[model samples]
Target: MRKFIAKTVEEMPPSGIRKFFDIASEMKDIISLSVGEPDFVTPWNVREAAIASIERGYTHYTSNHGNPALRRLIARYLRERYGTSYDWKTQTIVTVGASEALDLAFRAVIEPGDEVLVPAPSYVSYMPGVAFAGGVAVPIETKECDGFTVTAQALEAAVTPKTKAIILPYPNNPTGAVMTKEQLAAIVPVIEGSDLFVISDEIYSELTYGGRHCSIASFAEMYPRTVVINGFSKAFAMTGFRLGYAAGSEEMIAAMVKIHQYFMLCAPTASQHAGEEALRHELDTDFAQVNKMVSDYNRRRTFVYNAFKKMGLSCFEPRGAFYVFPNISGMGMTSEEFCHKLIHEKHVACVPGTAFGAAGEGFMRCSYASSMDNLKEALKRIAEFVDECRK
Candidate 1:
């Protein structure tokens, strides 16, 4: 039975993030700041729309590319928000969250021996996604001194003849780093005049604190080669809905759709209906509720960043998303050891930065997505643990 398993599937490393989570789950009195999903419930209107869709008998399979109404609304959302345009009918394919969209995009474009450049301290999925598509995952490490933003020099140095794509995850997950227009512009020359595709995962686009999110696809040169991966989970508090879509050139999207058609058939019928309502109802109204959620997250973000500084931990102030990566090297322990001890001894849980990449060592990712009360208590426990470890 063991020999029957595929080598790739067997050899892949188990998720380091999940290892701590599983331990914390069985423990008592643990304050978890490891999970990344928003603690907020879905907006009432979106939930109601899904209920209505079910009542109206929208439970059957939809078109392989997803509902036209949802696709068109997504296109409009992109245009209004990012000032980018794509053919709703041919250039967008709604899948089961951005996770599936990423897989489909990689499978559609990658071949054996191709190389996909991924920035380090990234979401844990990108590397495995590339490998699952029979492509090599090349990690270009970004540092805290540089604010974790990838530059053209680093990107160009990593590119080889086999380079086929690049995974750009901004408003980044563990680091919570956001790339501004100028930052993105600096990398344009490296991508321009090349055949490399840009898989820009902007799932956290709406949660930026400094300014509006900038899409790589907004640039003229990058647009033709960029596949913008976005979803309802992060922005609308719809994680369980598992709804996301990809936008790209007609040819690329068509290829992805073919893979999606056979692999997933279609995204959930009710989720598609709910997604449309999210855009048409909440988003069209200037995102009143969504804006409120963002405000709350900002408050938590500030509190957590200040708390880390007060504790003498060196951490970059995150400008987007709901995480803070605090350097833990001074604690004289590996990130995994620190996290394990913190949870077991202090009853607080945070993900080790090494969960993201080897470059993330000496750091720990603490999500501020929990309530203020929870965050305050967790920080207090963490402070006690830090002090105890100091001596």
Candidate 2:
């Protein structure tokens, strides 16, 4: 059986984030903050749209590209919200989730032995996806002092003739770091100079704080080479619906759709209907529900940042997304050791930083997407645990 399995599939380890989550699940009274899911239910209007779709017998498969109406709305939403333009008919695709859209991007662009630059401490799926696509995943480490942004110097240094693309995981998972337009501009010279394509994951775009989210695709030079991957999961709290989309040039999207049509056929019809409604309602009401959720997340973000600061932990204040990456290096333990002790001793669960990438070795990620009461109690226990560690 071992010999029959592909070496790549057999050698891969299970997700580091999920291991602790599974452990915490079996324990009593554990407050798990490892997963990056939104706490809110899908907005009522979105869910109602899905129900109406089902009632209308729209349960069958949609076009391989997704529902035409949904694709149009996605194009409009991206253009209006992030200044990215795509032709819905030829340059967009509906995927199972941003996860699948990412996979499709890799498969479409990568040939055997091609290299894809991934910023370190990025989403866990990235390196593996590149590997499965027969590409090398070259990690470029982003520093905490720089807000975990990929600098122009770093991007320039990482590129080689073999490099085919780079994954821009802004509003980054595990770190919650976001790049401002100016920061993004600094790297544009490098990208324009190279043949490298861009895969921008903006799933957390709507949750940004202190500023609006900026897409690399908004750059005239980058727009043609960038595949912007986003979805309703993070903002609309529709993770269970498992829908996402990718927009790029017609050529790239056509190649991706070729692969996606054979593999996924299409995204869920009912979910597409729901997504259309989500975007439509957002546009019509000026993102009232989404803004409400973002406001609540901002409150939690402030509370968590202050809590960590009071504990004397060095935490980078997050500008986007709901997670905080706090340096636990001063605790004199490895990231896993710190998380293990904290969870076992305090019954509060969070992820080890090393789970993200080697650059995350001295940190740990804590999601602030939980209820305020839960966050308050968890922070209290975490404070006590930190004091005990010092002693």
Candidate 3:
């Protein structure tokens, strides 16, 4: 059996985040703050559009790059919101979700022995995806003092002859860190002369609690070199639709679409219709509903932030994303140890920081994606568990 498996596939580590989520699932009484997804249902209008498409006998494969209408909508949305523009026909490719876009982006550009610089405490998928594409993932640590953002100096230091690309995941998962315009601008000059490409995962772009989400691709120098990955999962609560898209320079998008053609054929036809609707004013209506969701998330964000502060745990104030990563080192326990003891003793489930990367070992990621009541209860249980550990 071992001999039959591909060496790379077999050597890959199982997802660290899912291990604790599986444990929590089997427990009798558990409050799960472990999953990184929206608790909100897909907006009624978006869902209805999909159903209507199917009912209208429109259930067929779209173009490999996805429906032209949806792609145009995606392109326009990015331009109007972030000031970045990509040609809908040649520079955008709809994907099965940002997951597939990320995978395709890696496969399209990475060559054997190439090194992709990934900032630490990132989404768990980036490293494995790079490895599967025969590229090495070089981790650049982002410090808490720097809001977990990789500085230009650090990025320059990580560059080597083998360095081929960089993975910039903002409103970052696990850490909830966001890179400001100035911070992103600082790195532009650093990589200006280098031949490195960038894969910017801005899936949580719409969930930022800050003024506005800025894309590294918005910079004139970075635009040509960056591939932007975004989707409807976080903002529109459309995860089940399994729809996302990638925007890059025309050449980069064409390469990714070639891979997408052979593997995925096309994204779900009905879902593409829904995606177009998601971008239209009809769905969000001045974004009042989306704003409401953000407001609620902000409330829960404050709850978790204050709860950790009250518990005397050290945590960085996250300006984006729904997660709060708190350093639990003072409890004298490894991240895994603290999480395991917490779930068993308090029946409150949160992911260990180590789940994100080795640098996350002294912390834990608690998502506020759960309901307000659930978040409050989970916080209470965590407080009690910390107190008991202290005693």
Candidate 4:
């Protein structure tokens, strides 16, 4: 018998989050905090728009770049929210989701053996997408001492001759780390003269705390070399809608569209209609609701952070997004070990930090996207587990 394997497909491991779900599925009365998805339903207006579009027979495949109305709306939304603008006709393209946008961005620029610098414990897609596109993923660990944000010093140290791009994940997934405008400014000088481009994932841009999101695209010099990937999933709780988009220099965006067309002809037709309302008319009202969700999550963050802090766990306070990435190194177990023991022993399920990347060892990511009742209950179980660990 011959072994069949391809370097690309074989190298990719199973999803870190999926493993927890699989294990939790078999357990009775499990409380899972491993989810990275939003728990909210799509807003009423957005859903109604999609339903109306479908009723009107707008079910056919749209233009490869997406419906023109949606593209225009996306461009408008970017300008309104992030102070970054793209030409709808020439610079924006909608895709299946931010996942597909990430895939397209990596495929657009990465080639065999090229090095891609990624700040660690990012959203699960970055390194894998790069690797899948035949690029090497070089993980640069961001320290909790610095709120898990990448500094210019870190970015400069990670780059080399083979480095072609950096995947900047601000309002980060697992860590909830956010870079200030000043913090982002620090890295611009490092890449000023390099041929490196930036792939900025701002999916969590709207979920940010009071401070507005700063786009790398706002930097005129960087605009030509940066591709911005964003979506309705995180911001509008439109996860199941599977609508996302990317904007960049026309040349790069066109290349991404070419690849997108050959793979996914267009995003869901009804989604494009819903996306139009989201970008143009509904965002302000919908984002108010999004902000309310963030406020609720912030309250839970305070509650959970205190729980870990009271237990003498080293937890960095997250400034944005809805996760609490507590450093569990003091617990004297690897993140995976701690997660498994907690789930099996105490019926609480949270993801190990190492699942995100090697640099994430000894940490655990907990999503506070659940109700306070569930969250408080999970923490009580965790307290009991910690007491046992200490024994």
lDDT of 4 by residue, 1-391 (tens): 2247776777688889889988988999998999877777887888999999999999999999999998888888888878887899999999999999999999999989999999998878788889989999999899999889998888888899999999989899899899988888888888776678999999988777768888888998888999999898987788889999999999999999999999899999998899887776555565677677788877888999899898788899888788999988988899999999999998888999988899899899999888889999999999888888999
Q: Each prediction's TM-score against the native?
A: 0.99, 0.99, 0.98, 0.97
Error of 2 at 371 (Å): 0.4
The runs of at least 3 residues in candidate 2 whose Cα sits more than 4 Å from the true structure, single-residue gaps closed, are none
**lDDT comparing candidate 2 with the true structure:** 0.94
> Once model 1 is optimally superposed onto the true structure by TM-score, how far is the C-alpha of residue 356 displaced, in angstroms?
0.5
Query: Candidate 1 — which residues are off by over 4 angstroms?
Result: none
Cα RMSD (Å) per model?
0.8, 0.7, 1.0, 1.4
Number of the top lDDT candidate: 2
Order of all candidates by lDDT, from best down to worst? 2, 1, 3, 4
For candidate 4, give the lDDT: 0.88
lDDT of 2 by residue, 211-245 (tens): 99999999999999999999889999999999999
Worst 10 residues of 3 by lDDT: 281-290
lDDT (CA) per prediction: 0.93, 0.94, 0.91, 0.88
Candidate 4 least-lDDT 10 residues:
1-10
Per-residue lDDT for 379 in model 4?
92
Clash count per candidate = 0, 0, 0, 0
Residues 84-168, candidate 1: write the lDDT tens digits: 9999999999999999999998998899999999999999999988988999999999999999989888899999999999999
